[model samples]
Target: MTKTVAHIEKVLEVANSTSAAALSRLAASWRRSAERHGLDPGEHRGPRRLEGTHLCERLGAFEKLMTVAAPRLDNLYSLVGQSGCAVLLTDDDGVVLDQRISAADTAVFEAWGLCVGADWSERHEGTNGIGTCLAEQRRVIIHRDEHFYARNTAMSCIDAPIYGAEGQIMAALDVSSARADQTEAFNRLIGAQVAQTARAIEEANFRAAFEKARIVVAESDDAEAATLLAVDDHDLIIGATREARRVFGFDPLGALAPRPANDVLGRADGPTGFEKAERAAVIRALTRAGGNVSEAARQLGIGRATLYRRMKRLGLDQT
Candidate 1:
């Protein structure tokens, strides 16, 4: 056996044994995948690619996601490029939607089959970054020889999962490098960056999905870590980011139900906060009720005259 494969076999032996002392969580995942999928660490498997109609259909289904994620992917690339890495965006199914590879490193990346429309699911690509992150539904760093397959030992990978407004995983953002060997500190740094970028993408997606709702950005010590809540015209929470749900101590499933925004966010202490929130709520009500003044009034639990007065005061009458 080759040296690399021999090393992998020994690692697997340790992983499969009863003693889990030396096995990292990721290594344990590799073992679980081996048992579940009957994977062979010794063999190199090329990533599967969807072709022709299948490829087109997959792309079509993910068109909206691509549109929302492209700019964020570009930004992530700029941040990680200095470290000789590229960014990849993939759908929940592990079908790559898009990639950003530096022109100088195109050949190196292409050789590993990191390209648009390629399937990188765990079933197809073994224990690589993108696939494993989706399988585990968490952030991961697969550095060098940590990869299950011997052939993938040369590259280092970091990936983070992006959750949808409904709390389901929507995609994975991966940053990978083959230029230089990666250290644990560097992996952690890049992993954090990847996760932050993924959260930004999720926030964008949340806003896009609730474009007409009043977006409530909750107060946070870390602006990047703030939670986003979408409140309808009746001041009821319609949707929220996963972080928002967690930070605000909300039940994940209960976030779907329409609850008073003030009940969750707490009423503003002064007139300024109250008036702004009230005006925003009125506008949202009008929007959700489709500009029907009577419907809007009903939703706001106010008479038509009151609704009209609020609109006039808020300068929404001009629109």
Candidate 2:
């Protein structure tokens, strides 16, 4: 049997396996591709490409993301382009919005439907890197025969999901290579870079969304995912990253209700109180004034003597 026939048979065998618990992520994805997506592993048809007005509309929807991600895509390509890889950025629906590929590899990637306007969602393309990453909302590496489709088995893809400012997946960053000698270890290294670049794009988008808010990094066990919070001038948490929302119990979608930063961070203040707010205001004024009592009092629009008395009452140190 040819390699394609062998790969098709292998995919069918794994998809029909009964041991669901023991299946690896790739196996699970294969099963999903066969059962959920109803994809034919033996199919040799190329991916569908949106053209003309349809392509432009899809690109327009992700214009902001493409703008923020352009530089990142360039940098990632610089790192991996020499390896005969193509860098692609796709919207949440798996429509490729932007791509960077060396001229030498352009025809090859285009032939494989890795160009702009091509759809790579799991439902369309089976268990490939970009598709599966967006499907599972995580980073993924689909190397060679790990792809459900026999035709896609020659390429290796590394991808990471990029989350928008609202803590939802807005795009995916993918690097694909058709090199025959690519190894899993090398793919892992590329996967790390892809994941880091995706996070950088996510952070840039988040920062732009809350330009006036103070961005703080929250503690997280997963280094690949960013845990961030955006605080307003009043110390209210106005926004959070996906991981932060998951970790801190914030609403995963929609506008977040403003909560005191201290409360969310589990600091000393349990609830907002008049005294706490007043003390916080005084502390902020003092900090802004570089600990100068007169300047702080002026900023607070209170007499120095009154400010000192309030400080004393609030147990603030006046050195």
* lDDT of model number 1: 0.78
What tens-digit string does per-residue lDDT give for candidate 1 at 1-319? 8878686786578557655624567666676557766777777657778879998888898787788889989898888887788899999988888899988888888778788778877776668888889998888888887777777788898999988877778799999897666687988988888888988888888888888776766644555552778876565788877777776667664347778765765534543333465677778888998889999888766678867866875557825
Over 1-319, each residue of candidate 2 has an lDDT whose tens digit, in order, gives 9988999998988888858515588888899999988999998899988999999988888888788889989999999999999999999989899999999989999999999999999999999999999999888999998899998988999999999887888899999997999999999999999999999999888888888776767667788887778876565789988988988888898778999865665435542333465678789999999999999988866678878877885779875
Model 2 segments beyond 4 Å from truth? 20-22, 269-319
lDDT against the true structure, per candidate, is: 0.78, 0.86
The collision pairs in model 2 are none
TM-score per candidate, in order? 0.78, 0.84
**Number of the predicted model whose TM-score against the real structure is largest:** 2
lDDT for 124 (candidate 2): 94
| Each candidate: RMSD | 6.4, 5.5
